[model samples]
Target: IVLAPVSLAAEDPLPSWRDGPGKAAIVEFVARVTRQDSAGYVEPHERIATFDNDGTLWSEQPLYFQAYYALDRIRDMAADHPEWKEREPYRSALAGDVKGLAAQGKGPVVEMLVAAHANVTTEAFTRSVAHWLATARHPRTGRLFTEMVYQPMLELLEYLRANDFKVFIVSGGGIDFIRVFSHERYGVPPEQVVGTTGGARFELRDGIPVVVKTGDISLIDDKAGKPVGIWRHIGRRPIFAAGNSDGDLQMLQYTTVARNEDDTTPRLGLIVHHTDGEREFEYDRESAVGRLDRALDMAPEQGWLVVDMKRDWRRVFPVAGS
Candidate 1:
């Protein structure tokens, strides 16, 4: 089987990243890494950058991707198990009444996650993820799940790569789930993605090595887990980081700490603040899913760039259908 070659050329593509502090920081970092005579000049292999998923790179409005996966799983598995039609959360999910389920609160949602996520073999889980991503559409927008990616972030990714940065997604979302479409959508291949993962075991299927998913859960990648996941998966510390909300606090902290160790090569951290209610949901300090309280408080003190989505993004989605 032949895979398309990954791109490793081109100039910094996001020169228009704006003239604010964020832009200046990024430009300075690039200059340092690229200068042959600079003490900060980093070899290409050392240029690691990590980004959090969810609201950081896409509109995680309405709900998270895992929630959507759970709903769809219930819907798909319901036909075989007729009892789900009468089950509490499953019933609501089957009826397309997510609000009703949410009204019942986290209990129902957790039940759904346990039922849909646990006890499956890793291969089965991957297959399930593939099936859902292939078929699912955003309820409100009616766009494919992969198509919901933020255009500006996509540009930033390309821009970073042009500057010799090796971009990786250290997200709380499932690794395989995001990997399914990230290569096509974000130009980030599956091998570079790291996220919260379920259990898996190796087996011999027809004398060939195969990975099976265990019903057991391993890690929940969120908040403090972000840095842990990055450390475990990528090994090398990132010189640049970007994320949204308090879930990304530890990641930003880790990146900033690296900057202090060596002043020669500047480290970069940016936070995406949800401020566009018309284009996407906007909330701070109190939203259940993507609460940004800690990040907002830390942004000023930490010198982390807080990106105002409304003010910064000229375009949100990719030309509606481009």
Candidate 2:
């Protein structure tokens, strides 16, 4: 695929990045990077920015959408494994009782993930994601999964790229899941996505060492694990980070912490507050999936810019066919 050259024109590619503080901060950060005399003059190669995928780039509620996909896949695969009907989370998930399933918390979620995501070759898993996204519609929005991506966040991605920032998706969603469409949807190529990964093995199916199926569950990219994933995967601390939930706080923190490297710029951290229930669910203090409690309380102390989606974003989802 012929990728378009990154555009750095002053049109504000991310019209959704807001006009006030949130917008100002991003603009200032970009200006600093471009100014040769500025303390933040970062060479293009060192201009790395990391973004959380689910709540950061798009809505993660009513539950991690990827979990929903896993549940759906589990249900489909359960026909072959009738034992899943009696399994804890799978049973609850198949029964359409998400609240009950979540009550079991991260452990049950992990079990469901292993059951559904494991044992599938990387190629097969990618094919499954492509198939599901092409056909599945979000329960609330009734739009294709890819269509549910935030217009503003998508614009922010393009904006960063335009400024010579090497953008990556440091999401809790499956790396393979986001990689399938990250290029087409967000313009971040497959290699630029970092997320929870299932273990796979090299198999010579036809004399090729292609990654094959495995039953191993590796790291999950969320909460404190976000920093761990970043360190292990990207191997570079990001100078800019954005996320929308407590799950993303560590990631933002990891980015904003002062760096000792001479070439690295001081970081910019922005949090997306989901304050618009009219357009999207807006329960920060109580939501389970993308909880924003701690991030809200520490925003002022941390000097992090909090974006109230209801007030900041002029448009939410991308317009049809956009």
Number of the top TM-score candidate: 2
| lDDT of prediction 2 | 0.80
Clashes of each: 4, 0
Clashing pairs in 1: 119-215, 121-213, 122-212, 122-213
Q: Could you give me the TM-score of model 2 versus the true structure?
A: 0.91
Cα lDDT, all candidates: 0.76, 0.80
In candidate 2, what are the lDDT values of residues 30-90, reduced to their tens digit? 8898778998688888888999888777777777777777788877787788887787878
Residue 269: error of model 2 in Å? 0.8
Q: What TM-score against the true fold does each predicted structure earn?
A: 0.83, 0.91
lDDT at residue 245 of model 2 (Cα atoms): 80
Q: Write the per-residue lDDT of candidate 1 for residues 226-310, one digit (tens) a residue.
A: 8888888888778889998788899888887645534556677899888888877787677766778978898888888888878
